[model samples]
Target: MIFVPLPYVVALLLAILLIQMVRRSDGNKPNLFFAALIAVYALQSLVIGTRWGYDIVALLPVQAILAAIIPALAWLSFEGLRDGRSPRNRPLLLLHALPALMILAFVAFWPMPISLALIVIFLGYGSALTWLAWLGPNALGSSRLDGVGNAYRALQITAFAILGSGFIDVIISLDFAETGGTHSGGIVAIGNVLALLILGTSATVAGTSQPASEDDGSGNEIPSPVPSAEDARIAASLDELMQTRSLHRDVDLNLNRLARKMGLSTRQVSGAVNRVKAMSVSQYVNDFRVKEACRLLANTDDPITRIIFDAGF
Candidate 1:
């Protein structure tokens, strides 16, 4: 009988996900980063299966480097959704790659502390991602409002998966220390495969929150100017515009398009809505949509399905 390892199965699933993402991509940076992350996870799973199942000792370093990369990519993919800033504008993005580069350096000369470094990297990124998610859907200012909640939940799941992987590493290390590496194979086979699968799936789900635009100039570093009288004015203008033009009825209405229509930056519009309405931009627009839907349902004899579509739901 031929035997197939669990990681190989995971690798195959992730590969399919990567292909799907690539095919569906709208040339968005978040989508591209998500595809790259899935591809990396698939590659890592393949390397793990080969090394553990086939006893391919030569692949150990490759596995280590890839493991280091997974968390970094996950972080970048989600971070890109929070604001539509491109990679070039975010200089700190290069810092995220340091962990993987360190792993590579360790692979070359000093391999002893590689496991410890990986644990730190995983836990650190996991915590950061968890915090980002904890900030709620509003934190992903650039994300499409319709899918922001799902993206936030996906971030939480991915964070937990990354943290779980770190804990699994701890368990495997303890197993090796206590049992002379006897049960490490089974633990790695099961624990890693599960973690990577969850991570990949959650990441794909998070990627669903596409940004409104790639270059809306919403830099994460710059603080949104404090709410002022101008914010109230902008909010009032936006309200008038939405009522007059029924912009909320457009199913594709997003921060970028709305801001462009108003002749303002996304930050200006989002900040105005957030300040004046005490809600996210999506919530504010969605309130108008909900109200319109209610009015239509009460007055018009339109079919419920048609009402939903007409209300931009």
Candidate 2:
């Protein structure tokens, strides 16, 4: 009988996933972080496959370290996707180092406390991901533009997938304790494979569909000059800004930028635009571009390509 390890299958799938993530990443911060997260997961699975399937225990410490880093990477990737920024701060990297350091210390000397701490890590990050998932489409920030609902849905699913992974960790930890060192590795291998498949697909979908970043250090919150009840006044100011400045001519314009230009909160801008324009911010912006395009097509002698660029279509 020829024996095939499930971990090998998992590793192979993850390798393919990594390649896709890399090809689709396009240097976007969220996508890059997501790719890194997938790479880490792949490395962890490779270690597990070698350890359990091949009985190689040399990389056990590496596996433990990878496990500690997974949650942090997952959270960071989600944050990058949400906020459209990925900080390269050294302190953040150092903070993530704490988990791996604790695991390494356990591997070297103190082994008893690490188990409980691992559970804490899992449940803690899982709760956070679950909360973000509960935020629904809003959690996607500016990425919640036209034709992007599917990507947002994929991200929500991925958040739940992360939460599921935390519960799986709890189950595995309990199994480890209850079995007195006789836990079935096959079950864990299967669970890891399934979870990785889900995460990889969701990450790819969400990452590739991400809108280009429109933030230019101008999205910082400023006090709303008008009260919430005065949405009409805000709407009027926004219209004046759009008409006078032709801000809609910028292809990368978003609600945040519009709000910043008008000195209003995103919520205020969104509400005003929604109530007054009777359409989404993206739709409202497109209306201006479409009108301009129609004008150019009807009256202009310029080439269609030049007219398209000029009209910001």
Candidate 3:
């Protein structure tokens, strides 16, 4: 009788998810990053299963490096969703990679601190993601309005999963200290599988909500100007455009596309909507969609499903 390890089963599931993501990818950076993150999780699961189940002593460094990469990739994938672009600048990219590089350094010359470093990396990135999610769906200004809610929820789940991974590490560390690693195997087997599954699934959902764009080059960090006459004019122009052109009917519409139609940067459009409407761009557009759906439901005999599609929901 062959006893199959749980992580191997998890790796198989993650591989399926990775393949699905790759097949569905539209060459968008966020999608690709998400796919890579899933791939890494699959590989890490396989490595963990082998190392623990089969006692493969040679895979320790490989597992450490891969573990380090997961949190960084998760951060980059979600950050891209928020910024509407991957980190293209060399400096920014390097800064994001610093934590993983440090882990690699520890793995190479100083293995004692490897576990501590990983715990720190996971907890730090998890906290960062939590903060991003706490800012609300508006923070993901690049996601399609119709899907922003799901993306926000996915971000929240991923944040919690990452934080859970950190806590798992703490538990394993405590177990090793108190019991001489007696319970580490059981903990890793169950804890890691659950964490990877949650992280991978949530990331896949978030990727589907990402807009297909290389870069809008809009800096979201800049302070939004107070609602002024200029903002009112921009909001009026946007409203006129949406009403006249029925841009809300486009199911794929996103902030970048709306801004392009208005001949303004995404920041300008989002800021104007935020200031004048006192709502995120997504909520503002979704309001239009809801109204259209309601009108159709009241006046037409179309199926609810058809009306939903027509409303771009």
Candidate 4:
């Protein structure tokens, strides 16, 4: 009978997910990093599968390398989704790689140290992800994603998957100790394969749900403003701009562009819209687009396709 490794099957699915991310990534750093994380997990599964399924002793060091890097990739990808900032701090990111570097250095001579290091990395990063999830949507405030509410749910699932990975490692370690380092490889492979499936799918869903949109603006925080004449004036000016120029029809309009057109700062625009409309700037903009769409739909004989485009939706 021809041998078929489960990891190979799972890794193949993950590879397909990675390719989808790349095709739809559109230069979003968060998505790209997420894809990289998925790639690492896929390779990790493949390595573990090969080492156990074929009993390849020489591949042990390679497995060690992939395992060591998993936590680092997890943390970095989480940061990417949280911050939604491109061109991240490269120097700091390089620091996360230290664990993997240490593993590569000691894998040949001191395998025990590598094993201990992986344990610490998994536990530490897993706890960190869990804590981040505990913070809820506020933790994802900096993200430019559209469906933050849904994304947060996906984030929680991803966190649990990482946390599960840590627990799996602990269980495997205990099994190794109990069996004199001869625990069942099938169990380890199955656990990791399931984990990669969950993590890869959750991360992909969360990352893709937040595609770049014109309404996302710069995603800079806006200070809340007291309702006052200045706020009303700014809001009125924005209203006039939208009405007179039909700027809402642009479909590419954002806070910065709207602010620039009105000769106001982005902060002022955001503040004014928030205080006057009692809603987010994106919401305020969408309201106008929705109204226009409604008008087009009711009064014109335009198809929905044309109406959506014409109404800036």
Candidate 5:
């Protein structure tokens, strides 16, 4: 309410924090996701701006708009596909349209009290969340999102938390209603704080927080490695190598040379391979080399040493 700019203050802080997060991220995907979050703030401003000295009644339509946007933002932030494309054939951009649709729904059902409108508002929001889980990245294979150690699990849990919150809110509202809005009086306030806390925590874990982790700018946090010209050449070479009768045959193949070819630092390449495949680069390479050797041995290879060398040992 304008009388007590708490909502505006909270929303403004979160909006700023999220924008900073986007700026700190080295990846475009995370940046895009956080941009959606910024839009949420813009939305809040749009609704509340009209009420300078008025009560929260002026903010109801704003909340109505937010109902759909909240869920949509959650989906975009956490559940984008492996390539960052939405699972929806149209790229799931449809999720962003939800806020408008919801606002329209409110107008179509106008003259309803803010309370009743909120009911339908939450209903649409909840449905969007469920749909995201059903058809978005949540339904995709877990292996992709859950990479290694607790990384994938962390992501999955956050995704679940977003969807779960909607249900929890429903139960809270029911209880609040049973006891007359008293219980829900400060509910929105509490929810706002908690939401930012959760998002901030996730941003920290996801490497979007600043002042940087390890607190060092000199080089504790490595730069993002992309496919340079040389790296692309190496990738292409590796692809061709994989097509051969023997590629993984080199059990002791030097990683330095591979990293050199790929235009990646040894640490960067190692981390990427390990995180993506859940195995050390050496072990992965060695295992593949052994498999190739075995295949040649069982099939029709001229000699074991030849097969070993051919396999990239």
Candidate 6:
């Protein structure tokens, strides 16, 4: 069946790729939450594509994954957005787990009422996650955030919306299984739109243009950019600064000075740094240097200021 395309597919794909990139970029430690997200998506595809989807009993794994994945992700996504507070609504999150376990356990023994209950629970999470996902973009305008985080967040939100919508629509499918009348009309329409949202978000979340192994600054090796006039200058200057062996020795490298040395448009330079390196130029330069200084402070006879300078303060 044909599914319309939308922005959500891009988001979905990005959500998958972002964590993997972050993992590779930072260290080999993969995020279980993000990895689980990828599995949930694959299972969703499997359920939708195969004949096993029609058989709820055979779809136990799919349903179980959907139930567990959405709520946990919703909570985690919310935490990331809010910068991880102590989790005030612990009870609410737990309630979500209960319904999932209930569905999983009962499905093994009972099918009818348990299926209806599962459908209802799915609808609830579907509606909630979808709303939260769409809500993030509206609050954080597409133009406001830096490219990497914005793209990652956008994908996160869009995927939740699409998959969430799919869950809700599927619930309605169950509700209208027998009659398939006027009540089903709304569900069908909603399902179609949700399907498109899923497609778009999925593409972005995956970052499929590059293989899983490569990470050459685009975060995905989609071929190095041509290095526009602005980027070329910034890259050259940064390379020069790094090679100087003295500049990196300083710990307090000012953005204004760097801006002056590069002589390119500061805005372009900043954007390039963010998109290419995932950090502001000042941060890119100073943070690691600071860490080095701290290490020197603890381990050597270097004076604080000397260490700071050595670290490129």
Clash count per candidate: 0, 0, 0, 0, 10, 31
5 versus 6: better lDDT goes to = 5
Candidate 6: worst-modelled 10 consecutive residues by lDDT: 138-147
Error of 2 at 117 (Å): 1.9
Residue 299 CA displacement from its true place in model 5, Å:
40
Model 5 Cα shift for residue 50 (angstroms):
10
- TM-score, each model? 0.75, 0.75, 0.76, 0.71, 0.50, 0.42
Question: lDDT values of the candidates?
Answer: 0.79, 0.67, 0.79, 0.70, 0.50, 0.50
Candidates sorted by lDDT, descending order?
3, 1, 4, 2, 5, 6
The candidate, 4 or 5, that scores higher on TM-score is 4
Query: Which tens-of-lDDT digit does each residue in 1-313 have in candidate 2?
Result: 8777777677788788778657654564335566677788888888888888887768777877788888877776666545554466434556766877888889899877766777677677768776766654435554535424445556566667666766776777778789854564766676777786786667566555333233211122222343445878887887788789887677656555666677777766766765665555666676787788899889989999988778765
Q: Write the per-residue lDDT of candidate 3 for residues 189-230, one digit (tens) a residue.
A: 889778766866675765564432221112132244579898
Query: In angstroms, how far off is 134's CA in candidate 2?
Result: 3.2
- lDDT, residue 149, candidate 1: 55
Error of 2 at 102 (Å): 2.1
Model 4 alpha-carbon drift over 4 Å, by segment: 26-30, 88-90, 200-289, 296-303, 306-313
Name the candidate that leads on TM-score: 3
Alpha-carbon runs more than 4 Å astray in model 6 = 1-24, 28-31, 53-57, 60-68, 85-96, 126-156, 159-176, 179-199, 202-313
Candidate 4 structure, TM-score to reference: 0.71
Cα distance off (Å), candidate 3, residue 19: 1.7
Residue 151 displacement (Å), model 6: 5.9
Candidate 3: which stretches are off by over 4 Å?
26-30, 200-235, 244-246, 249-251, 256-313
**In lDDT terms, how accurate is model 6?**
0.50
The TM-score, computed over Cα atoms with residue i paired to residue i, of candidate 2 is: 0.75
Tell me which of candidates 1 and 2 scores higher on lDDT: 1
Indicate the worst ten consecutive residues by lDDT in candidate 4.
211-220
State the local distance difference test value for candidate 1.
0.79
